[model samples]
Target: MASSSKCAFLVFLCVIVLLAPSEVHAKSMAKAQGGWYLVEGLCSKFPDCNKHCKEQGFLGGQCLKLGVNMLCFCIHT
Candidate 1:
């Protein structure tokens, strides 16, 4: 019984570890010169980012993929 419990615990741990990272991730632009930061968000197309970017008051926005997910990048001055 103790061995079975251990196995179950290990399986649970494995699932958590394996699926910990998501396919899509949102991130800010790195080292954007002139105070430009890359904004990241989940998206499926270019327009999807426009609203989000406008809300943030960014100069513009664009959609990009970091892994398996589409992210919207809002560019601000």
Candidate 2:
């Protein structure tokens, strides 16, 4: 029983270590791609970000046409 518990713990630690890099990379990518910052029930788009959406350009102008609530929350500067 003790051996099995140890093995399980070791496996869990190994999984965490292996997955950590990908998780960090994903977070960095999201930051790099820009993200919605929540502030007082308002979501603000990162306009001065290093990355921009090539399809719609910026969230302030055309992406506003998607849905009223979502556009309001996500498109605010």
24-69 per-residue lDDT for model 1 (tens digits): 3546465565666575656754456877777777877777675655
lDDT of each: 0.68, 0.36
Clashes of 2: 0
Estimate, for each residue in 16-53, the C-alpha lDDT of model 2 and write its tens digit. 98765433311111121255521112113424232333
TM-score of 2: 0.34
Best by lDDT: 1
Superposed on all Cα atoms, the candidates' RMSDs to the truth, in angstroms, are: 4.0, 11.7
- Runs in model 2 deviating more than 4 A are 25-77
Ten residues in sequence with the least summed lDDT for candidate 2: 24-33
Clashes by residue pair, model 1: 29-38
